[model samples]
Target: MKKILMVATNVDQIGDQQTGLWLSEFVEPATEWTHAGFEVTGASIKGGKIPIDPNSYSNELPRVWDGVMEPIHDTAKLTDINPDDYDAIFFCGGHGAMLDFPNNNEISALLDHFKQNEKLIGAICHGPAAFVGNKDVNDSSIVKGIKITGYSNEEEQGTGLAEAVPFLLEDELKEAGASYESGGPEAEHVVVDQNFITGQNPQSTHRIAEIFKEHLS
Candidate 1:
């Protein structure tokens, strides 16, 4: 079986502001990939713990899913892993990632390494922001010319977290030189750019995972 690494944030808290990641992000994609016969290993920056937004995990969503759980309610934290061994790297988002993941030198380095090796990279919602930091060995933005999308500015504003998230995702992505474009104002759309797959919001999880599975195959 091909090995795939699943990366989710240890981020459990939403901004003093709003909730994100929504159970759909983890559950649908995880379940889909697991069902697709890929060997998936879930990991976070800190080993042993992972965090899910309390709000998103609630079963009110029409397609509510809750797949990504440790044997515990809390998420797990993983110290390090070999991105090289994995055929693809996936980042699951939550509001917490906006706070913890952006500055993780290790994640940035891993993304750069995976991107350099031309390995497939996956990021959803705020998770995609993590990849926004990757720079090529030449220092040029690796995603500068690529079409991509993530949590959009309008989505942030709608959630009243425009100020809570470190930076506006759509704006920041464009700043990083990505040819950023989102599906619609809603977070339910998915965008795939070759080796890089992105989900606009939690609702996009299922499609994103399906596309990832197709690409991995």
Candidate 2:
């Protein structure tokens, strides 16, 4: 089975909006990958446990919650996870991710591993914020010349967190030299660049996972 690594934020606050990995983004996508028979591992900056945003999983989206089929392992064990051991790495998103993941060395190292080993790297929503600090082993921009997209600045403003959230996802990706594109601030947008696929928001979760499986399987 293909092995996959999932990285999420352990922080569960969003200036009182209640945040972490959006359930649909993490669960729906991982479910599709796991059911396809891949081995999935969950990691957070803190390791062992990660927080789930209560608002992300509502009765409005039952399939996503039900689809999440397994327990997540400690991410700190990822120090031993070679990119060669996993088919791809997925960074799930939520508003809280913007607060916790950007400056994390662990996340940056994982991205570096994928780049060096030529493995897939996937992310959704503000999860792309984790990419803000990932540099290629050679010290050049890693996502340079790479087509990508994530939660747009407009969406951030839409959420009324342009100031509350510390950084801007689209602006940071552009600053990093990624060839960014999106569904134009829409909720269900997804972008794929070879082994790197990104979902625009929680609504884009399942489709993003399907895109990942289609390539890996």
Candidate 3:
């Protein structure tokens, strides 16, 4: 079976607002991947209980998804995982990712490993924040000159946290030289550029999984 490392942020706060992993962004794809027989491992920057964006859930957690929530509630430390052990690495999105994913040495190193080994790499929504300051083995920006998509400035503004986020994902991707595109606000948009796959927002999770499974096959 193929192994996939699903990385999420440990950050649970963004300013005075509540933020963490966008529940659907992580759970939806993970459920699909698991059903497809992939050994999906949930991990975070810091090993422990992963935080869920309060806005992504309601008054009660869904019991139907309890199995999927297990690893998320107790994730492994991203730094402790060996990139070589997985066929791919997927960065799940949330506002918190903008705060923690970029400039992370471990994440950069993981991206480098995946690139050098020709392994698959993916990110969704704000998850692309992981690529902001990351470079490949050649020292060029990993996203430089690639076709990619992520949470747009429009979507950020829609949440009314445009000013709160450290940086806008769409602008950062373009500034890094990526040919960024969007399927309008809150629409399903997935971009595949060689071994890299990116999704525009939470709405794109299911399609991202389908495309990712196709790539793995």
Model 3, 1-217: lDDT tens per residue? Answer: 9999999998999989999999988888888888889989999889899999999989887676678877798899987999879999999999999999988888888999987787899999999999998787677888787899999989999999998899888898898888999999999999999789999999999999999988886
Best by TM-score: 3
1 or 3, greater by lDDT? 3
lDDT of 1 by residue, 28-135 (tens): 777787777887777777755555577675456444234434422443354457677788888878777776666466777777777878788888888877865657
Query: Candidate 3: where is the Cα deviation over 4 Å?
Result: 60-64
| 149 Cα displacement, candidate 1 (Å) | 0.6
Quote each prediction's TM-score.
Answer: 0.86, 0.90, 0.96
Query: By descending lDDT, how would the candidates be arranged?
Result: 3, 2, 1
Q: Point to the candidate with the largest lDDT.
A: 3
- Residue 124 in candidate 2, Cα distance off native in Å: 0.6
Q: Sort the predicted structures by TM-score, highest score first.
A: 3, 2, 1
lDDT for 52 (candidate 3):
90
Model 2 lDDT per residue over 1-217, tens place: 8888887777778775767767667777777887899988877766666677776655476654463534443454445656667778988888878887776666777788887777889999988888886676686666888899899988888888788787788999999899988787666777877668888877788788888898888
Model 1 earns a TM-score of 0.86
Q: Roughly what TM-score does model 2 have, to 2 decimal places?
A: 0.90
Q: How much lDDT does each candidate structure score?
A: 0.72, 0.78, 0.90
